[model samples]
Target: MPAYTPPLADFTFLVKDWLKIDALYQSLGLEEFDAELALEVIEQGGKFATDVVAPLNREGDEQGCKLSNGQVVTPDGFAAAYQSYVDNGWNAMLGDIEYGGQGLPYSMAVPVHEMLNSANLSWRLTTMLTESAVLAVTKHASDELKAQYLEKLVSGQWTGTMNLTEPQAGSDLSLLSTKAEPNDDGSYKITGSKIFITAGDHDWTENIVHMVLARLPDAPAGVKGISLFLVPKFLLNDNGNPGERNALAPSALEKKMGIKASPTCVMNFDGAKGWLVGEPHCGLACMFTMMNDARFQVGLEGLGASEASFQGALTYARERLQSRAPQGVQQPDDKADAIVYQPDIARMLLTQKALTEGNRALAMLYAKYMDIAHNSSDEAHDNAEAILQFLTPICKAFMTDTGLESTSLGIQIFGGHGYIREWGMEQLMRDVRIAMLYEGTNGIQSLDLIGRKLTRDRGDMLGITRNAFAELVAGMASGEAQQHASALLDEWYQTSLQVKAFSAVDAAGGACDYLAYSGYCLLGVLWYSMADCAAQGDNPVLAAGKQKTCDFYIQRLLPRTAAHKAALLESADTLLAVEGSEFDYL
Candidate 1:
């Protein structure tokens, strides 16, 4: 495994040059969070991730988590690292100031999280879920509930978990069987078992706040009847501190392939005291506030792992002596030239670089919209919201899908070394593998994009993407950027309209391919913008790298959209024609 050096330069390029954070803050009335401050945060976060958290990655994986009795014990040094994470105020960076948070824009937290995820993903999982939980509680919880939980949660004195899955229900909440009975003291007694809960039980904090989804008695059946509840590991006492243990505990720990350091628990809540976060039957809506944030963060999870694997593979490729280059013997003094001289290796590395960097830009841009949606009072706020809703699925699905690709490329670059755990490439693959499945699987996300975002809005949201590309094309100085942007925009408009006209079955069948097409197109436009910025910037080396990567993306990867588009145009009849029993040859 190679040492994790945060991609500080790329982060700076995106935040400072491409996105123009300073100007953005001024426009959005967030004067306190300038580009300079953002850079400072990234630098310090990188240091913490490298110095404190990274060294524990391999050890944590080897040791994993230990479950004895009803409690879960994290790897050695995890608790201390988490405490340092709290002491350094990393946890509260994006929390509201009213909740003892610094009240910074969520964009500022993006790079820091990426660094953390790169350095040590297992340790980062708990914190990631905690932040998502905080968002849900902040948005929907009552004032009294906020007063009790916000301070500790924002301060990182306690952790959080999202408990939504059960034995019978996964992505489909309509099948949920958990019961929340109303109590006399205005609380609800929650009873049911929830599975696949991330960081469900941990020792890093004194208490864990679980945002659970359950059904209320007398409520309508199905997803509409589901309600959100705040179930704590420990009930609060008069002093506002953890006191009695709640009637909830981890019944079993999931034995997983990766992220072993993070506890994925089967939690059983037996008559646990909980309070409703929102109106009855509105739980799914409230939970989306958390799920949406988690989905984006999950996308970042894939990006981070991809980055780590890329760094390791690149390091190995450069130093490891191998056969001579096809062109010539680059390292005559050695037994053979380094594998870095191989053209195929270059392709793999460049592919990883383009995907990782492009996704970084996409994620950061999405974060900026999040800021605008939160801070602005004008039409920009509404537009930002629309864009966020429209891009959420793309960010989650595309980034992770490509993330898996990038990580697998890392393994291929490493050859046999990548297949083993010693090089860390396999672990990276295993860890990111789950991202495409959880937080609403990539399949689910694609359906949401084409269904809720497109059909529900009558393709109105398609204009957001179209308009953005048009604006980029109008401002682009380089001929290449203009050409690519223009062509992609035209195709995007046509494909979007075609998909919008798709019958429900056709749309459902084509959703995944459409999402892939959208992702590739979106990245193409963003790559052009990044290349344009770098081309006009002061750094020659960075400019050259960006230009070449952009060229690779445009020439090589952009062709993928054609295949996806073709698949999208295909009807579902072929798929539906196949009888279920006809495939039972096995």
Candidate 2:
């Protein structure tokens, strides 16, 4: 296994060079976040990840989580590590100050989260769920709810979970059978089984707060009927101390393919006492407050996995002596040259770096927008929030998909050693694979992107991004690489408009299917502008690397957008034509 090292140089490039982190810092009102501070935090983050968390990655995976005497125990050393996290105040970095939190901006926490994910994804999942739960409680839960659960959750003393899916309802909320019958006491009795609940039960915490989605007895059907509830593992008294188990327990922990160290349990909510957060039948909206954040977190997770795999594989390639380069008479004195001598290996490594780094920049930029959306609450902040909404699915879907690709490529670069469990490359592959599936599958992400995001307003988001790109390009039309720049800018504008046209009048109908085929185009458009920013940079090395990556993207990656469009233009029947029963055997 390779030592986990944060890509500090590349982080600097993305922040200071590419996205102009100074401006973002000012935008988020963090006047003190200068280069020194940013570098210091990143360095400290690297040390914590490498020294404290990385050592636990393998041990956690091997120890997994255990159920003994009706209590779920985390892997050895997890309790200490989690306490270290709490005592150090890492959990409060992205939270609000009013709720026993530090109130540091998310721009700082995003990379920290990235390091944790790369160091130990299973351990990181626990933190990820905790963050999401806190955000949800902060946004919608009443002041009373906050007073009870906020401090402990913010301090990472007791973790949190979201209970959404059930055996009867995976993605379709209309099919949900979970019943929330109201009591005269203004609370409710939640009776349902929620599946795939991450961190559902763990000894790392004193109690678990589950943000459950269920339906009231008199509520309307479908999504409109859903309501959010705060269901705790133990009943809390007026002082917020755990009183007793509230009819919720881990019926069984899922034996998963990856992230086995984090318990994904089938939680049985058998007449659990619950407190409703926000209004009745408004649960989905409130959950989105968290899901959107979780979706972006998934993107960061994917980037971290890809970055880790690349670093490990790159180190292995540099050390392992293999066959010489394609050209003959290479390394005549030695047994063979290192794999680094091979251009293809370099190409793979560079491509992985390009994607991983680009995704990092994108994720941080989105996090910056999140801070603006939540804290600023102005007109410009509102627009940025909408843009963030449109980009969220793409970020979540593309990063994870590319992550799996990059991890697989890293494995291929190492040959049989990559597949071996000892080298840890295989674990990266397995772990990264889950991001593509969780936080709504990539297919679901695409459907949401087109059906909900674009079609609802007929190119509303597309228009915003296109107009911004054009305005930027227009400003730089006469600057360096003007010819390529001017032409691509026009193409981007045209592509945006064309995709807008792809949405039907009842745009939300089957265009979602079309989006599955053209999701890559949206990603390309975003990356095109990003690469353009870096390509037009002042630094020699970074500017050249950005230009090359953009060139590689245009030459090899952008062509996929064409296939995506063509597939979109394919009849809707291309997808619906396949009967579910017909494919059951396959």
Candidate 3:
């Protein structure tokens, strides 16, 4: 296994120096959170992730999950690790205070989650899904439902899963066939199968709460008929304990390419006892609450994988000697200098660093906005919510895309060794590939960004983000950093106009390119903000490194926006001109 170390320094820089989360907490009246408390949580969370959780990562991957007679068994050490995670109260870190939780701000939870993901992504999936489920239930479920399930889930005594994907219905929930018939006791009998259900069946928790999407008999067709139901693995007894088994079981575990330890189960719900969560036919809206949260978490998965890959590649490059440096040998006594001296190797490493760091900054900023959106009472709340809506898809798609690239670059850095299992770089690459596919694919995210967010709102969200970026640019010193920000803002404004115009013609054809363009521009803004923060800080070395990374992103990576913009602006006819049957000639 690759030695995993949480990037505490980076977290400190982001939360403390760059974003100054203390001010955010004060503004939002999050009295329990301060810089000291936040750092302490991060430090302790890092230890748990590194000591207990990370050790299970390689073991889980090698052993995977086992199924026997409908019962799914996790790999050795996993159950124990999960117990430890629960014992430490990590699961309840961000839960509601009314429900036996610490009620920490989401911004404080961001670093902790990043560390957990970095340590063991497969293990982290269970926790991530459960957290999302908790949010959905809290937001939409009735008081009675909350009284029954919230406390246990918040306490980590029970786990949760979101069941949205059926074999026939992946992204298109409108075609779902799950059936929910009204029962005499005012409950519902849910009978259907859901595929790719992460943590669907695990031995770690006594009861698994499945937030399922199904249809009523008398309901309207398509998505309008769908309803959200809370179906547990064990039906609650009169005393509210898990009594009789619900008519739900894991039919099979997916033999996937990566994250083997995380059980991707095909769940069969046969007349399972369940209760409606939100209103009938409004399940899609309720489910979006969960999906949106999961999307941001998935984006962090990409950031986490990239950080892990970078760590592995950086360690290997510094130790593996190859040829002399172009200038001179830094280590003259050795047979050859380390590969870190090579320009191309440096390029790959720096690119990974730039993307990972910039993504981290953006993710943290997004989390801060989430805190404001959820907790703040000021006039900024509306703007914060809008920005969060706008950035969620970009964060989900762009971060994961860069994660895949960074992990692949790790393989390149390791050459032959990276291809093999011993180095552990290959696992990072394989595991991160799914982040783009699940929780709404990157293509789906692109369409959401262009068709719904940008076009439907007449660039209102984009205008909000642009104004914010403009303010940031205006505050900066008049130099290269300010100039880069100005140029990016100009390009962003012009491209938004072009995409809005072009999307009117063919929304689907230009959506992906437009999203890519917006993603790069957003990252550029983040990089400049980081540079600006560093320049004002007292730490000279850290400031210098941040400046260099910012310059690299501006010079090398940000220019990719041009290609995406051009593609977005091109007439859809270029793509539509190629008929479906013409490819048969190949």
Candidate 4:
């Protein structure tokens, strides 16, 4: 296969032309964010992905994480590469400046993350989990706690892990049984086991900081009683050096199907000494602060893997010889034409391209939301925050779902080569599968969209998306950009209205239940809005690709909304009344 290009031109078109991220940065009052810097960052990220990380992906997956004398050793080049990442200050891309970070907008960090993940997801997982820890501390940890531990985490000197899942509680925090008892001075002694902890215990860093969830001795039942604790593998003394060893240890490493390079450990917190990150009984809410950021990051991971796979598959499709062109039969003199010459093959390739391009645009749009939500000085900040809250689950669930599907298509595009591990296409597939499962599973994401985000806000979220789309359309109605953006907006508006009607009906199920099946409609509106945003760009091939993908999504992808409409309004009976066991007969 040919060396991978980062699709910089496409990225440029999306950020500079289509999304007009400059406008967003200006809205956020971020003076440092601009076209030149963005291009430089993305170009550097691409180089890092293709050169340093991509080479190690296969090696990491094959070597996996080795268990030795209770120490989890990562693959070769991984620890050095992680240090390189920290030296480059990549982990603190959007972290707090007070903690020695760059404090870039999440928008700026979003695509940078995509490029990094695309280059090599396994290696990037460590950096990503580290950022999540930074978020947790930045939001909830105290000045004293931050002063003691924040610098190392932000600098990536010490890695971090979220200890939420136990043997019984995967997604349900209510089922958690971890315990914390008060110490004389205010610290707590934590005891319990956490399962599926990513980067839990590794030799990569001198110390590991675990953001653990546990119940106090006198705590009430369920989530409200839960508290967040900063439990490090090795305690930090006043001088910030590794002190007495903490009791937290990896009882065992999991054998997951993918991203084998990053260790997933079942942690044993044996009366481990820990400090509360935020106030007790308020941990879950504070943790929500990090969850949204982590969810969006997961979406980018899926997008990156899909893109890398597509790039590999596209190269293979264009060069590999296959059948002759249909019937003028112009390739009669040659042995055969490349597979790219086939219409069906072209359709599949175009589909992957369409989703990849659209997915990137959508990711940046969500990041743009993040930039404004955090940095904006205007009153519009609240509105932007609402929009981000509303759309985040969609971004996390929808983009990743499309990303996984696109990668599967990328594999199919490679046909035989896609299935073989030697071609490296299968590794991308294995790596991306986890995106749908982690940072909140897609099913839970759907429930969040319909149950919490859409209805609980009393259509505030609906209003935000509707108003934004209206303004985007209204901007082009009299502007010079109308020629390119007008029709797209009109179609999007009509669809949005249809979605409202589709959601408004109190079907046999509740409103939340209605949208569980109809969340895809909400996504249709979002995807089309992004497609419209992409339509405004200048570079013709890139713009044409955007326009084509936008149109194809509407024509090909949006029609699923019709079925959703049917399912939401008229078919509720068929849905719930269906025989549960008959449908699942053994």
Candidate 3 residue-wise lDDT, 104-133, digit = tens: 888789989988888999999999999999
Highest-scoring model, lDDT: 1
Please list the residue runs of candidate 2 whose C-alpha ends up more than 4 Å from where it truly belongs after superposition.
328-330, 468-493, 503-543, 577-586
lDDT of 4 by residue, 102-192 (tens): 8876756777788888878888887888888898998889998899889889989998888899889988998999999999988999999
What is the number of backbone collisions in each predicted candidate, taken in the order shown?
0, 0, 0, 0
Between prediction 1 and prediction 4, which has the larger lDDT? 1
Runs off by more than 4 Å, candidate 1: none
lDDT score, candidate 2: 0.78
Q: What TM-score, computed on C-alpha atoms, does each candidate reach?
A: 0.98, 0.92, 0.98, 0.91
The lDDT for every candidate, in the order shown, is 0.91, 0.78, 0.90, 0.76
Q: Which runs in model 3 stand beyond 4 Å of their true positions? A: 477-480
C-alpha RMSD of each candidate structure in angstroms: 1.1, 2.9, 1.3, 3.3
Cα RMSD (Å) between model 1 and the true structure?
A: 1.1
Tens digits of per-residue lDDT, candidate 2, 1-586, equal 6568988877776667655667767776778676567767777877888888889888777778886666778888877888888888888777777877877667667888899888988888888989999989998999988999998899888888888999988877778889899989988999999899888988777788999999999989889999999999999976779988898888888887888788888888889999999999999999988888899889888888999999998898888888888866467788999888798888788778777866776687677677677667667676777778777887888888889988898898899988888888888888888898888988788778776676555676766655544544454423544455556656645654555555353233344434433344444444555566665667678767766776676666667666655655555554556686777956
What are the runs in model 4 whose C-alpha is more than 4 Å off?
A: 1-3, 330-333, 477-538, 570-586
Q: TM-score of predicted model 1?
A: 0.98
Between candidates 2 and 4, the one scoring higher on lDDT is 2
The alpha-carbon lDDT assigned to residue 292 of candidate 4 equals 82
Minimal lDDT window, size 10, model 2: 505-514
